[model samples]
Target: MRLLLVEDDEHVAAALLAVLKRHGFTAGLARNGAEAIEKTQAGGFDVVLLDLGLPDADGFEVYGQIRRLSRIPVIMVTARADVRSRIHGLNLGADDYVVKPYDTGELLARIHAVSRRAALDQASSDGPASGGTGGAPAPGGQVLTAGPVTVELSTRRVLVDGARVELTRKEFDLLALLAQRPGVVFRREQIISDVWRTSWEGTGRTLEVHVASLRSKLRRPELVETVRGVGYRLAVPPAL
Candidate 1:
């Protein structure tokens, strides 16, 4: 996923950026509020990690500007952990808030959470005009085949080795999104946004749960390959 890390602390930003990159995310750094706003205006960002402490302007102000500019998901990553600050950020439309000195794992989760939500909201606004659920292929519209897995989009039906495999709404959406582009690694953010219709970081666990369920239901553990440290891809077994 593409991310804009808006932070002023060079050391902190550098460390976080390195870790984010190692985890397979493309991230850009903006040292101040102005830079953050400027970079966002350039577009192509999936989420913004905003630090409230900026030299030029208040983080809140920057956030407000960003909200006015675009609906991009923004997570407030700052040291302001007070109740009012958190409440205010939310009131200004911050998707999520994370206090400083937080576990990196948790921060990443929050980022994913907000992004997922934004994706879902975007899809909802599009109102099926995007021809898919949460940006997934429209049901009853087409059939996607990968190896022994056959996904009937129009019917939301799945058949493995010619036997029907019932799936939940999310399960079907997730599988269909992967099947649409077999062998390609779909980032967790993308999957959550497209399938769950939300880029919520917390949804990661839910996605994992759904994946496990899908594998069990399909009786094909190898059907969805996990790309370690990245995301997931469909593993279509070679023809026998």
Candidate 2:
């Protein structure tokens, strides 16, 4: 894969470049946020390894610029291991966040995982209007609604109470999954396997975080009901 390494530290970048090369990846280096954005605009990299501490601008700003330009997956590599930073990065369109002092093995794994997810998204976008075959189709209509929130599967759009609501990738997926069959409880394991394509053992917290974020974004926390030891269900509000 052609990868972009956006880091100002030469020694760190050199080491990562060597590791990526040894893993049979074609990699390019960007020393700051501007250069990274410029290279991304030029169009070549498959995935971006972005460092938040940039010389010209904050990596988050660079991430936003890239998002405006392309749908290429970006993984944030930074020293910020705080939950706030992690959530912010994901909220701003990062495919993954790798904290500093990360294991090379784990970083490689994240790179591959993010790339796979991006490829799947592209494939889904290019194919039918049905979207990913993760869960049931939105039965008879492209839009799925529960309470005041309406989700358009084909366009990946969400509107809450007549107002457009912006959701992160995972948050949308989670809501769409439950919204498919409102009032039916979906097991946690099933959710992880379907939405994240991973086991619940390590990704449970991520599921919870996404759920919380979804509730906050939709402004209807009660819409997605917790089923205690089981999982969660979408509470379809009674008709007016």
Write down the worst ten-residue block by lDDT for model 2.
131-140
Query: Residues 21-84, candidate 1, lDDT per residue (tens digit)?
Result: 8655789999998899999999989999999999999999999999889888999988887999
* Candidate 2 Cα misplacement greater than 4 A, ranges: 129-240
What TM-score, computed on C-alpha atoms, does each candidate reach? 0.69, 0.56
TM-score, prediction 1: 0.69
Off by over 4 Å in 1: 129-166, 173-212, 216-220, 226-240
List per-prediction Cα lDDT, in the order shown.
0.81, 0.82
